[model samples]
Every structure is written in structure tokens, then in C-alpha cells.
Target: MKSCLVVDDSKVIRKVARHILETLDFSVEEAEDGRQALDRCAAQMPDVVLLDWNMPVMGGMEFLRNLRQQDFDTQPKVVFCTTENDVAHIRAALDAGADEFVMKPFDRETLESKLQIVGVA
Candidate 1:
């Protein structure tokens, strides 16, 4: 099965994402913050990552930069799932190694579409 890491500070968001990803036949894992997400990646890198922007320990952009610096044969496709819908935020995320972007309050369709666009769905 394909694997995915959902990184969000909000428990509700993580739970919702988990449900959607599981239905899509993905082995889902959850991380409350970017630090935990990084640890999870180090232990076992997932095929994709659904990352939130404003995390407590570490933000999504910082985590993306750190993750990109790691030596991986194939880096996980990162999708920034956050409320930062501004063009600059999206562009910065894309330039920081994110494969796609999705806004907050996303439904199943939106999440699935972004994942598909990243070629991980």
C-alpha cells in the first residue's frame, strides 16, 4: 500500500485527513508538528506528506527546507495543506520543494485532487 504522512497541529484536521487517505487505500500516519513529522520521515519516509503551515514546534516551510536537505533517493511529494492561500505563500511553498498546495477546510475531493496532481493518489 502507498504511505502518507499527515502533519497538522490540529487534531481534527489530522483525523479528517486520515479518514480520507485511508479510504484512498493509503497507509496513513499522523504527526502533530513539523518536528514530529521530521522524525517520522527519518524513521520511515512516506510516499507523500500533507503538511500544515502554522505548526508549533516547526512550521511547514521550515520542515520542507529541512526535509529537502536530507539525502533521500526519492523525496516524498509534499503538499502544503494550510490556510495560507496567498500567491506568495503558494509560490514559496512550491519553491521550497512542495509538489502541490491545498487550502484549509478542504473536503475529500480537494484533498484527493491535490494528491492526484502530485501523482501519489
Candidate 2:
């Protein structure tokens, strides 16, 4: 099965994402912050990373930068899921190695579309 890492500080968001991804036939994992997500990647890199913008330990942008620097057999496709819906934010995310961008309060369909755009769904 395909694997995904959902990174969000909010437990509710993580739970929701997990449910949706699981239904899409993805083996899902959760991380409360970017630091945790990076550790998870180091242990076992997932096919996709659903990343949030803000968090306590580390932010999504920082994580994206760091993640892009890592050497992996196949680098995970990062879908930046966040509330920052500005052009600059989206551009920055894309430039930072994110394969796609999705806004907050996303539904199953939207998430699936993004995953598809990244060629991971």
C-alpha cells in the first residue's frame, strides 16, 4: 500500500487526515510537528507528506527546506496543506520543493486531487 505522513499540530486535523488517507488506500502516519515529521521520514520515508504551515517545534517551510536537503532513495512528494492562501506562500512552497498545495479545511476530494496532481494517489 502507499504510505503518507500527515503533519499537523492539531490532533483533530491529524485524525481527520488519517481517516481520509486511509479510505484512499494509503497507509497513514501522523506527526504533531515538523521535527517529528522529519524523524519519521528518516526512519521510513512515506510516498507523500501532508504538511501544515504552523507548528510549535518546527514550521512546514523549515521542514520542507530540510527535507529537500536529505538524501533518500526516492524523495517524498510534499503536499503543503495550510491556511496561508497567498500567492507568495504558494510560490514559496512550490519553490521549497513542495509538489502541490492545498488549503486548510480540506475535504477528501480536495486532498485526493492534490495527491493525484503530485502523482502519489
Candidate 3:
């Protein structure tokens, strides 16, 4: 099965996202923050990453920029999954290397659409 990594500070968000991805047939792993997400990347790369913004111990925007700077070819397709709705934030994320964006409180169709946008659905 395909795999996905969910990087979020909120346990509830991570759990819910994981459940959704699992139902969609994607094996799921989780990280509580951007730092942990990087650790997951080093250990085993996932096909996609759903990341949160404004997390403690390393935020998603910084992580996205760092990942883009790395030489690794396996950096997962990143989808910024956050409550940040500012246009500037969204623009920065896209510029920083996020493959897509999904806001918080998303329904199943929204999640599926994001995956589809990245050709993972």
C-alpha cells in the first residue's frame, strides 16, 4: 500500500487525517511537528506529507524551505494542511515547495481532492 506522513502539532488533527488516509488505502505515519517529520523522512520516505503550520519546535514553512534546499530526490509531495488562511502564507508555502494546500476542518472530499491534485488519489 502507498504511504503518507501526517505532520501536525494537534493530536486530534493527526489522528483524524490518518484515519481518512487509511480509509483511502494509504498506509499512514505521523509526526507531531516539523522536526519529527524530518526524522520520519530520514528513516523512511512516505509518498506524501500533510503538514501543519505554526507548530512548536519547528514550523511547517521552515521545514518546507529546508526540504526544498536538500539534495534528496525523495522529498515527499507536500500538502500544507493548516488553519492559516492568509494569502501571503499560502503564497509563501507554495513558493517554499508545497505541492498543494488544504485548510483545517476539511471534509473527506476536500482531502481527496488535494490528494487528487497531487496525483495520489
Candidate 4:
């Protein structure tokens, strides 16, 4: 099965995302912040990352920048999962190397579609 890392500071959000991804047949891992997520990636990169924008320790943008610079065997497809819906924010994320963006309060269908768009689901 494919793997996914759900990087979010909120326990509830992580739990919800875990359920969705698990139901979709992904092996899920959770991280409370970008730093932790980065460590997890270094150990074993997941097929996709569901990243939140305003995490402590390190934010999503910083993580994306750092992750892009690393020489992983297979680059994980990053999808920013956040409340930030501004065009500029989206543009910045895309420029920073995120493959897709999914706004907060998303349902199973929305998440599934975004994952599929990134070719991870």
C-alpha cells in the first residue's frame, strides 16, 4: 500500500485525515509539526504529504523549501492542507514545490480528488 504523512498541529485534523487516507488504502503516519515531519521524511519518505500551513517549530512553506532541497530517492508529492485560501498563498506554495492545495474543512471526496490529482491516491 502507498504511504501518506499527515502533518498537522491539530489532533482532530490529523485524526480526520488519517481516517480518510486509511480508508483510501494508504498507510498513514502523523506529525505534529514540520520539524517532526521532516525527520519522518528523512527516515522514510511517504508517497504523499498532507501538510498544514501554520504549524509550530516549522511552517509548511519552510518545510516545502527544505524538502525540495533534499536529495531523496523518490520525492514525495506535497499537498498543502490549510485554511489559507488567498491566491498569493497558493501561488507561493506552488512555487515552493507543493504539488497541490486543499482548503480546510474538506470532506472525503475533496481530499480524495486532490490526492488523485497529484497521482497519489
lDDT string, candidate 2, 39-82, tens digits: 99999999999999999989999999999998877799999999
Score candidate 4 by TM-score against the native: 0.99
Compared with the true structure, all predictions reach lDDT values of 0.94, 0.95, 0.90, 0.96
* Local lDDT at 1 for model 1: 93
lDDT for position 43 in model 4: 95
For every model shown, the clashing-pair count is 0, 0, 0, 0
State the lDDT of candidate 4 residue by residue for 1-121, as single tens digits.
9999999999999999999999999999999999999999999999999999998999999999999999988899999999999999999999999999999999999999999999988
Compose the digit string of candidate 1's lDDT tens values, residues 33-61: 99999999999999999999999989999
**Residue pairs whose backbone atoms clash in candidate 2:** none
RMSD in angstroms, all models? Answer: 0.7, 0.6, 0.9, 0.5
- Among the numbered candidates, top lDDT falls to 4
Ranking of predictions according to TM-score: 4, 2, 1, 3
**Model 3 lDDT per residue over 18-109, tens place:** 88998999999999888898888888989999999989999999888877787776778999998899999899999899999999899788
Model 2 worst lDDT run, 10 consecutive residues: 66-75
Best by TM-score: 4
Clashes of 4: 0
Better of 2 and 3 by TM-score: 2
Which regions of candidate 2 are displaced past 4 Å? none
TM-score of candidate 3 to 2 decimals:
0.96
lDDT of 2 at 25: 100
* Window of ten residues with lowest summed lDDT in model 4: 55-64
Candidate 3 regions with alpha-carbon error over 4 angstroms: none
